[model samples]
Target: MMGDTGRRRRSGPRQAAWEFFGAELKNRREEADLTQAELGMRVFVSGGYIGQFEQAIRKPQLDVAQRLDHILQTDGFFERMWRKLIKDSPYADYFAAAAELEALATQICEFAPTVVPGLLQTAPYARAVTIATNPLAADEYVEEKVAARLERAHILKDATRPVYWAILHEGVLRLPVGGRATMAEQLDHIAALMRTRTVLVQVLPNEEGAHAALGGMMTLMEFEDAPPTAYAEALLSGNLLDDPALVKRVQATYDLIRAAALSPEASLALVESAAEDYRRCASTT
Candidate 1:
């Protein structure tokens, strides 16, 4: 287990608050004379999950926090604290939990049918997407979101963890998000990461008609000590799924989509070619 100082150093001030929550949970659980597994069983989560929560390696959802209040007889203290902590999060309510899990994942596989995945987005592209969805949002709000998205990308710099794999539809390359120059820069960044072996990407070309996961974006995350989970997002809502049966189904769909994508080598060439075309177009403009 990492010390509080180490966790705070890596995750910053927000992490200190979560660490406080974890420490309190640990103290209360011990007072109740409950083993971590016993507490988890009562709360309907795994023992390992309870351990993660206590370590501040994962944050609990509202419902789980409420359950903790009930099981531990904390008089709603956990629930109230949870609401306060989540309210301060920069990510969308639907995405905050998933974003936390992304840091702890051992492997992440994403399928993007429209725009580039947030982890792969450049600042310009992220800003464009933010504005596209919230055209009336204040500039400060937009910049905050772009900064948060870019911060998530830093996980890739770790060099020794969370093997990232992404499959982007061909349309994602040609979307001209933020304009030709921005799209060119985005593609170039992805190509550079591919060349450095920082991430693996495959393109699901337009020619591969009617592929699986055509509905929206899906991410499957594998953890070192916990069961794998799947996340699917559409429009305004997102769902994180941990049920073994549901995760298995999500995994199967991802496998099918991966099968339909171009080989990594071919995909890199396609991405580079697309970037060149955008650069050419931008030069003319």
Candidate 2:
């Protein structure tokens, strides 16, 4: 397995192109005598979001790009640029937008009922999950996926990283993902991060019964300048919600789930205990 050096590089020709796109957008908007907010209003996105696009911190979807092209009278230049850059995304089409926003968020809260969130997954655990989902996937594809996931995790290591919080269900700890040894390492990693005060974690016990956000996984993110957004994922597809009412409701559901979860200290104990159990099983085998 590759260490930090093996992390997928997000720079190169594509990075240069993204920067150019941002610069061109900014120049065109100025030439048109339009403020960022005015341009965003014509394109049906928030002014902050437009600024993010201009700064290359976030990517725009195809529809949004088309809108931008129309507003700027660029004769589909933005759309063409978007098409070329989009083909390089490692994430699924449904999740690419949310992933982009993740790097720009100031705070992130996740409710994970089945598996650990991607931002917290170790390489082994991430590889195991990827291969399980695509049993016939080629080795190159698996490695690419694992590398992409690890790259995403690197955001947590950044000095300006968001305040991250996660609530995991009891079953997430009990499930022996990647076998005992891998699970042991995974839990230990989480515990270690908690000890360093890098992240806050809580666990919802099985006895808690059903909850408002139990049926699916929810990720809520708050940005420094942009409006808040929420993402929900299921078997294959995911939805990113930006509407004020919808985001507020998702936030409320997350708050409810958090209230029902064990305290952070107790959750650490449970996670450490689970790691010990796996260590023993791994040793025996």
Candidate 3:
């Protein structure tokens, strides 16, 4: 058996739910006499993925959970657990609250001053950044974070995913977060995302100096079914702002920041250039 580590054993209400979820899934699957591989085939995911679910290292998509509930004859048990898992905070309370809102947002406008936005981060880049922030973090904790961050990207595949708009500071392009190779891959991923037309990224040039959101980062989420919300972050802590006035203020500042940043086409050019620069550095070193 694997030792407790990473987000699997991370403490929080959400962590407990995930533990229970794994136990319940394991019991139900075994009672049905289905091996992990057998269950994976029925769910159309890999056996390894099923194992992750059983270990509570990763949570399944809602559709996946529903299908599992069906296959295991759990009668909506998985579905209910899935809901609780998503609604609960996976990170800090405020950060997780914003994440939950992001899942349902119709439009996600983000302003990142220091680094690449989490949703836009590649696996290596995300892992490196997480480790850098918490140098003492256990390897398992880091792996769990990488899993969670990558999982956020899955939202992009959803047909109903919100329009993703991000403005990145120029420093983000210059700083080599995970050294040359990782940063190269990171920039390549962002450039590719821009070409895909699902995301719009604008770069705030160093020449442009400071903008409306200079000291911190902000994510503004607009929802068709509910009131809009905003989140601000610095370091490990963040806040989810539900006040109408505060949300509006942040939205307006974002608009100003966007206006000051380079156009999407131009930003893509810079991103591509930065990627090549990293690749070049990697080759020489």
Candidate 4:
């Protein structure tokens, strides 16, 4: 686990490159049917070090990548890819950190009031929301952000990863993004995710009224080796709070809000009903 200062310092193209390289290395080793210990022997690194690199828990030096490429007989494949993969992605630095943390988290809980959380948004909804807020962003930039957000969903289905829980405001389901059809599809997607045992989806209805988190959306991420962190983002900026007191305060607020929300079963019914309403509206049009 990265220290708060280490996390702040390690956000950028360099980290992205390392994450990419780590994933690639893991894939290659598995394809070659080599254990971590065997791979470590070939690469001249310890098995524990190899495990850390694969988990993106540690960044490998350039020399390490070169050594691994030669020993693995990949002919500098990883080294060459590392140079090309470091180009800046459209996501903000904080978002990149959040993405990495989200991937590795043991559990995640989110409270969203305005819009659907990124992990649950459909492509069209995500694109429309991004373009509306970031009007100046290039088409490619919007696409990249949408793609990154959607990629986080993979963790939910990954058997080895942690469970995910999200609580969204009723208004999010009511908001008609990209038209009724798109909104219906988004609701359908959320409903589908709810069916997974590892995911819990709840909704705080408008009738619930004035809950503790009237402020804004926040995500609490708990990891195995590190203390929990709370992340909040706005139009152009984001803050990651690791101070124990602040995290606890935000977490307490989230707990209160979750208590006010409909139970998971009730939330599923609400989402399904809303989707039905959207479908009806779409049919009429």
Best by lDDT: 1
Lowest summed lDDT over 10 consecutive residues: which window, candidate 1? 1-10
Question: Which TM-score value belongs to model 4?
Answer: 0.70
Query: lDDT of each structure?
Result: 0.89, 0.86, 0.80, 0.78
Task: For each of the candidates, give the backbone clash count.
Answer: 0, 0, 0, 0
* Per-residue C-alpha lDDT of model 4 across residues 1-285, encoded as one tens digit per residue: 554544543466657677777888898888888888999888766776688778666545456788878767788897776445433544665465566666657789998888898888889999989898888999988998889778767666655656688999999889898889989999999998887666798999898878934658789998765568788877666777766889999898899899899999999999999999999999999
TM-score of each candidate structure, all chains considered together: 0.92, 0.87, 0.69, 0.70
lDDT measured at residue 86 in model 1 versus the true structure, 0 to 100: 74
The candidate that wins on TM-score is 1
What TM value does model 3 have? 0.69
Error of model 2, residue 57, in angstroms: 3.6
Residue 103 lDDT, candidate 2, scale 0-100: 68
Candidate 1 wrong stretches, greater than 4 Å: 1-10, 213-215
lDDT of 1 by residue, 1-285 (tens): 644423433476777788799999999999999999999999998888888888887788888899999999999999999888777889998998888788778789999999999999999999999999999999999999999999999888874557999999999998899999999999999999999999999999998858944557999998665679899999988998887899999898888889999999999999999999999999998
Ranking by TM-score: 1, 2, 4, 3
lDDT of 2 by residue, 64-115 (tens): 8999888889999999888767667798878877887786677899999999
Q: Ten-residue segment with the worst summed lDDT in candidate 3?
A: 1-10
